[model samples]
Target chain A: MKIVITASGEGLDADMDSRFGRAKNFIIFDTETKEVSALDNSVNLNAAQGAGIQAASNAAETGAEVLISGHCGPKAFRVLKEAGIRVYNTEAKTVRQALDLFLQDKLVESSGSDVEGHW
Target chain B: MTIAFASGKGGTGKTTFSVAFALSADDNVTFLDCDVEEPDSHFFIKPEITGNEKITVPVPVVDSGKCTGCGRCAKVCRFNAITMLGKKPLIFHELCHSCGGCSIACPEKAVSEIQIGTGVISSGIRDHISFYQGLLDIGNTKSPPLIKAVKKKGDGASLVIIDSPPGTSCPMVTALKGADYTVLVTEPAPFALNDLKIAVETVRILGIPFGVVINKSDHPFPQTEEYCRKEAIPVLLKVPEKRAAAEGYSSGESIIKIFPGLGDEIKKAISTIKKEAVR
Candidate 1:
């Protein structure tokens, strides 16, 4: 399964970005092969409006089945749910740590959006 | 000729001067309160509203039955108002600017326009003066359309006075555009003087002739006065700060009504504006 993590920098050692929509980069990791790739999200980082919806579309386009971020807004959550993407929230930890928690089934999956639409 | 009262800084007495000037003008004058966000001139004018119309903007509505969600609408939207989620498109109305580009870009003929009210434009009469004002709904960010609706009512009046919203932004430009002349009202302070320079630049760029009216002129800030002299911009009027005037203003009374002698000064200012406008 492909999992996308919101990250502030490249590689698994990068810190997790708290903001899902305005994160500086998105790291896509394959659970089986452990292959990792970085997707630049700077375009939506400074958007005047609708950054969450745009970011959700970008994540969905990657065909990732799951998303791991520090937080997710209502609009982005709705969009991701429509795309059949499961979202999980985590603390301010490194991408590799979040992946380990998810692999151990210790990460809490979000039932509903944890933040407001424009957050 | 249309005269707009503008100020780059908020609470710089744009509405005060506009209401006072409208009241002091002849009976055929028309007052357009273009500050849709907070139309306060209605408090002083007390126009008997005869007509009210809703101001709307077009937003795209998707027909789910025919929509393939090809993502064309989402791709064409510069505002990011549309996004294709799975096989459907979600439209964010707040971010929509009613540009109609998304509707046109929809290949499935599934997009249609629906009008949503952002504000209201009301027209009425105060004595013999025709009064119009636009009131933007709280939380609505689209104000330029409502400002345009207010300005549309000023076409046939012998004299049109527009009370512009404060700031040198798009809303202020919408209010000040196409006016024969503009009267920039500012207080005598460093902050106000700084904003006044920006306002002056805006009008000058628009190629509109404008003069300055220093409200609370007795506050002993000479830098504003010096700036006006250096730029050769006419000082149309200087309304001295008076306790009675401030009290009356808070009670929704005009300056001319509070101090009847100021009527002469307003009259002189009007004449000066007319002469400058013609030149």
Candidate 2:
């Protein structure tokens, strides 16, 4: 299945590169075939408030079936849901750890979010 | 008459101007603070909310007895708000937008809809100015619902000044929509200029007539004037970069009270906007 992961680019490390809205890129991965591609989280050539939806929608247009992010805002969540994508919040990590967790089925997919105060 | 004060970025004096304009009107007006995420206008106006209404939206609640372990709800849900693990579909109410598509998409007809509280819209009065504001519930995703409730508090006769949230996003869009005219507030700085350009584009796209009000105008920046001249957008008013004014704001004093001419300027602005709104 097609999937999108919001990652803090800590250079493929276990620690999250940064907080939400500060992620370096949204990495779109494939579960069935294990392929991966990424889109920059930066909007307007700079970090913006909540680029998750734009990133996810771009991924969905490429047939993303799932979205993995550190956290997401309501606007992004609404758009992703309407696009028929599943959202999962994973452990804080770099892009690679997130994808690895997803491939190993170790990532616990959650509908409830720990993200708050997202504008 | 409702005049909306909106900025593309925060700390551009939306609340400061709205409160000042309302205080200066010298009439029993209402100041509606639509910034639910951080409704700070109340801090300056010091209005105590007298009435409040909860804002709730419908969200899907799965009835496992009827779910049948099928992943249709999960598959159909676009937000990943519902997931089937083992034999039950887990519902995340916070993430749900209450679109009801999931209930309709479920062949088993197992999912039901329920109300989830996101925030509250409240009404209050401070001296000559009546106040209505929306306070978003922590952990809630939706804000426009609360904004709509706050908008309903206006009586349509009294002068209604709206203190809109920062940014050119959905919340700002909802608050600014249907306003007679919006006062684009900004600073004379590079960051302010960039954000104001975006704000101008947003208002223009929405087909609303807007003019610029340069707050802290005396700041050491000429780009604001240069940009306005280039864009041909009118400069409605200019409040100099005065530290005393900043002190008054922090100390909760309305600008019209300290600076008498502000009320006159705002009245002029209202007249101008009224004339433009008719066209």
Candidate 3:
């Protein structure tokens, strides 16, 4: 299973970014092979609006089944759920810690968006 | 001639000047309240509304049967209003700008445009002035379309007066567009002077001729006058601040009626604007 974690940097030691839509980078990790890759999300960072929906589209295009982020907005959550991607809300310190939490099944799956649309 | 009254700061007396000017101007004047978020010209004009129409914008509606989810609509949407998830296009109405790009880009012609109400434009008459105002729906952020709709009603009037929204953003620009002249209202405070400079820059960029109207002129502030002189911008009128005038304004009374000689000053300003507009 592929898992996408919102992060501020590319390395495993980099802190997990709390913002989902405007995160600096998204780290994609494969649970079986443990292969990691980084996708830049700077385009949506300065967007005047609709950053969440654009970020959700980026996540969907990545073919990741799971999303681990500190927060998810309403529009992004709806799009991810429709794409059959399960979203987990987490406050893990680092990207590696968030991956471990997901592997241990300790992360809480969000039933709906934890934040408002624009937040 | 269309005259737009604009200010960079709110509560700087744009509506007050607009209402008073419309009342004092010739009989064939049209007053357009372009401040859709808070249409307050009616408070002073008290127009008897004769017509009201809903202002709408086109939003894409997807037909699932014809949609193959090729992601064409998603690709064409600059606003990110459409996203394809599992062979289905999800439409976010709030983010839609009614550009119709999605429908045009759709290969299967599955995307259809549907109109959604964003506000209402009402037309009426108060004495000799024909009044039109746009009222934006609560929580609706699209205001330029409604402002355009209100301005459309001013075509036949001999003189059009637009009460523009505060700030130098899109709505204010929409109000100032195609205006023959602009009357910038501001106070003599520091913040007002700062914002007035911004407003002046905006009008200058649009290449519209504008003059300053200093409200609350009784307050002793030399900075505003000095700035106007340095910029070579004409000071069309200066309305003195009075407790009785403020009290009358709060109670929806026309300041022209309360202050006897003020009407002549407004008329003189109009003639000056007309002369400047020709130059």
Candidate 4:
């Protein structure tokens, strides 16, 4: 299953990038296949804002099953879920840990409300 | 015609220009402040609210009995506002945008729509200006919903002035959406110059013709004029920096009253904007 995770390298085994709309990097990884790669987040200026959605969509298009992130805004959260992608909400967990949690079915899916950077 | 005063950056005198210009021209003009998050325009134009209407956004409501743990609703929701766990669906109101897609996609028809109060749109009346303002309820996340309600109060007359919020976001878009003209209020500082560019971009994006009005013209920033000229942005009027003028604003008094010539200046600005808009 394809998956996306919002991970902080320090605490969460995840990709590292500058602030959304401000960052220019995306570190992608596949825990099950142990594959890792990086995609440029600076595709375009306007796309900076729509990055989360783009990343999620790209992941889904690649047949990824889940996306994990430290936090997701309401708009991006909606976009990812609407794309038939499952979302795993985590706090300060490494990307690997989050992926592990999801693999173990221990990751909690958000009923929204915990997403940040809205309004 | 309505004139909306806006700037992408805050503290750029959106309220000052909006209220002053409204009071200067139409004695009976309606002033609407669509900046529900921080509505400071009322401080200058004090009007008693005559009417108010609650604004609500639709959110998802799940019926536990009907839900079959199918997770279909959760899968359809783009906002992740709904999640299925162990034959139950959890619905979060704040994350919902009221799109109703989840309800439509729900195979079990268990997901229904509910109203979430976002804010209130109020109508107030002073001596002449009919005041329509939106007050986003505390803790409410959205301001566009309330701004839409405020814009509805424009009765299309000699003058309808709107004081918009200080950002290039949805609320600002809503405030300036249908205005015949937009008056961008800014200072003569670097911050003002940068934000004015953003505000200009926003206005242009909305296809609205706008002019720049330097609030504190006497300030030492020479870039305001240079920037406007470079961008081909019109500078309608320059209000020289004056202590008495600042005092009036500080005391919540209209600048036109303190400086009688301001009324004429604002009137001219409106005419220039209209002529340019039609041209």
Candidate 1 residue lDDT tens string, B1-279: 899999999898999999988888865789999999999998888899999998888899999999987889989999888998767898888889889998798888899999999899999998867999999988888799889888999987779999999999999999999999999999999999999999999999988999999999999889999999999999998888899988988899888887666778898889889988833
Candidates by DockQ, descending order: 1, 3, 2, 4
CAPRI-wise, candidate 3 is medium
Candidate 2, CAPRI quality class derived from DockQ? incorrect
* lDDT of prediction 3: 0.91
Worst 10 residues of 2 chain B by lDDT: B80-89
Per-residue C-alpha lDDT of model 4 across residues B169-226, encoded as one tens digit per residue: 8778988898888889899998888888888988988888888989888899899899
Score chain A of each prediction against the true chain A by TM-score and list the results.
Answer: 0.96, 0.70, 0.97, 0.64
Where is model 3 more than 4 Å wrong at Cα? none
Q: Which one wins by lDDT: 1 or 3?
A: 3
Best by TM-score: 3
Candidate 1's C-alpha runs over 4 A off are A88-93, A97-119
How do all models score by TM-score? 0.91, 0.71, 0.93, 0.72
Against the native chain B, what TM-score does each candidate's chain B reach?
A: 0.95, 0.92, 0.96, 0.93
On DockQ, the leading prediction is 1
- lDDT comparing candidate 2 with the true structure: 0.75
Which of candidates 2 and 4 reaches a greater TM-score?
Answer: 4
Q: Which candidate comes out best when scored by lDDT?
A: 3
Question: Model 4 TM-score?
Answer: 0.72
